[model samples]
Target: MGRTNGGGGGSSPSSDSSRKFMEFAERNARLAGRLADLKVGSAELFLQTTEQTRMALCISDPNKPDCPIVYCNQAFVELTGYQRDDIVGQNCRFLQGRGTKPEAVSKLRQAVETEEYTVVDILNYRKDGTAFWNAVHVGPIYHEDGSIAYFFGSQWDITELLAARETIVENERIATELRHRTDNLFAVLAAIVRLSAKDTDDAAELSEKIERRIEALAGAHRMSLTGEGLAEDKSNLRTLVESVLRPYRNSHADRLEIEGGAFDLSRKNITPLGLTLHELATNALKYGALSTVDGKVRVDWKETEQFVEIHWIENLGSASERLDTHPPTQGSGSGSRLINGVVRGTGGSISTDYRPDGLQATIRLPIKNKVSF
Candidate 1:
């Protein structure tokens, strides 16, 4: 009876051991099934998030030949004007067009080959053949083994932003140009007022002189700014000179002689040239050649390939007797300084000669190529 009881005890222990083993196995199986469900749910959530995002997203399979696109979200389709079916299984380079920069393409290509992240502002075309600037961000999606699984690209249409930036730059440029022009105009006016005050203490006389000088400046400004009905945005040298001297020519046409072939002067140089000529003529009428009858002023110009040389000569005739009175002090006055400043601004040079006969001036200015405003 003792042996049989012992054998029964042994059998009961073996059965208990087997039962515990089965229970452990069952617990492990249930845990595994729960873990699998969790993984599937996570993947589905990721896919949903990507699909719903506004950012244009696309996935290219590197394992596939040529790394063609395998997945693209709805936003990508809308941005590129391509259907999902048409986009899938094609390389992303199809978006490139003639305007696309080769440097950008090379950078993108290198990034993909080396599994590096990169961003570029590249020109791209849509399915409808319209061009747009695309700011693209691309990087590698790696697998758990630290190997590249896919290349992920996100793109944004930055065409409008780029256009706005360009417009701002252009506006700033125009503002700068206008400010420069205003400053130059004001400088010339101030010089005129200061110099005119020195010549005469009479307010009426100074006023008349200032008015006439201002009118000459205004004429030049009008011609330079408006082109004076010329098709091009430039003035003819002869035309500008004749117009500036027109006031002096009215009373004595024989006293002023203008001789020059047609040479184009850029609008930028017109006002300065006009101002210089006006100062010279005013001096002549006051104390030089134009102070007496039979005094003659001859203006002429010659042009070379790169420079236009202007000559202004005066014959004092009977007025030569008064040469010692003024002594050709043209280069030592405020008017002379103004002339120098404006001429130098145009990249030109001027020289004055005080002879026993009269005053002579020579100006050489560069002929700049025509540019569109």
Candidate 2:
């Protein structure tokens, strides 16, 4: 009975140890299974997030030749209009086309070589050959050992944004041009008012003279805008001169003559040239040759490869005596200043000679290269 009791006690301790060991083993196994399930769940969640995200996402394996695409999300496929089977193992550079800028491509290439994060605005083409502006971001995915494992890229379509920005820039440029034109018109009107006041003391006469000058200016402006009395996209020298002199011609058709070959003028030069001709004609009607019936005025022009030269000659006839009595002034008068300002502003030259027999004027303007306005 003593031996049986000792053996039973020893067996009891052994049984207790085996039971405890079995309990520990079971707890460890359960923990390992839970850990495995958590890992799988995390991977599935990551894939779901990437696939459902609005921004296109792609991954390329660095270990592969050419760093070809190994994984791409649904959004990426939709953005590029490519199926997974078609794009897999293909280099992302397949998206580039002829319209893609070299500078942008260079930047992306440099970033990839260095495994650095970079963002670029690139022109990319879809599988169907449609183009879109893409704002692309690329960065390296590193392993725990600090080695590059893959390159991850994200893309967003930015075509509309770029177009909007361009539209805003064009609007600003047009506004600036309109403002400049308005200021120039106001200045010219103010100068006319000041200059016209010097010639007449009678308020009615001054008002009439000012009105006539403004009308002439308006006529020139209309021709410039409508391209009337001019060529399709240019101004004809003879046509413009005759149009400006038409009002004076009605009364003295026999007294005025114009002689010029066909010559084209830039649109920018039309306004200034018209203003100068109008001023000259007005001065002749009031104080120069055209004040008398017998007086005659001749206008002519010649064009060269580099310049267009114009000549104005007045035969004073019986009015020749007035030059001795009145003695034509130099460029001291307001009328002369007006003529000078408009002519010189266009990189042209003008000169006037008050001879004993008549008044003579010459103008030379540079010929600029043709351009679309």
Candidate 3:
């Protein structure tokens, strides 16, 4: 809605506020001549109409040395907390102070230099030095000779609007994070159940195995979520491998061996890789070397120019025969596909070799230069 004002031009008092505007064509003969070239009409009641407008308006002379303000309406004076005498002949940049953005200033400069229109949201200070967000629109008015005559500027205080928008964006981000965490929780649980079911036929045994796997997965998930791998205490390759094999090393200290240089893994990849390692260890405990008292498994990894190669060799130097070899079962194939899918999804590959000595597996994944966690 717009404000009403008494006027001398018409008896109706221009009640149609939407039609009220600054009549640039009738102010000066030079301006009137310029507006004629643009096919714009004259406004006899310019001051009366523009005085009631809420929007701030100013006109500057581009032909001047510094593009100083020549005319400013009542709204512009009220908005800046400045009187007509203090602001006239001064550059509009006097409103800019400490917190103004340099990039936004650069954009405004480019627009004005090229005599093109531009809109920018910038921080400006009132005469009292109080800060406010101003959405400013500026454009050039051309003379009949195709030369730039004056630069017109309009402004609106949008501090509250911007604050509201930021609040909504933050709320949406929090909601999205909550949804992702809940989904990950369910996914990790389902994976544990699927992999544990393959290792046992008895219900009790499956339950016990799932409980242990869940404990390991929970620890890894907790660490991954703590600071998204950016903090100083972020989990790395060493911690990830240890978390997966912690449950398997209860009584046999010498059964598992890990050798790898530490590096950061994104939170997104931690769970998938952790589950893959858990699956491999579970398979060894069921039918491979881990089934025997003297069995041993050595896990080693090294980084290359473009990839990281990880090797899992069971009973590497032992004389134990490959036990309970029933050509790849349905359960084993499912586990293989799950592990393969995880590796492939991360732009990697996995291969399993069943030799007489033991099961040798190799996983190769590309080394991403940077990871977002």
Residue 97 error, candidate 1, Å: 2.5
**Distance from true position, residue 85, model 1, in Å?**
3.1
lDDT string, candidate 2, 162-263, tens digits: 999988887786576457545656766787799878867999988987887788777776666565432243677788899999988999899999998898
In model 2, residue pairs whose N, Cα or C atoms come closer than 3 Å (at least 3 residues apart or on different chains), thus clashing, are none
Give the per-residue lDDT of model 3 (tens digit) for 248-332: 8775578899888887664556666776788788877877767776888888888888777778888834646655552231235
Model 1: worst 10 consecutive residues (lDDT sum): 1-10
Q: Candidate 3 at residue 18, lDDT?
A: 15
Per-candidate total of colliding backbone pairs: 0, 0, 0
**Per-residue lDDT over 99-164 for candidate 1, one digit per residue giving the tens place of the 0 to 100 score:** 999898888887776556789999999999999999999876654334456778999999999999
lDDT of 3: 0.70
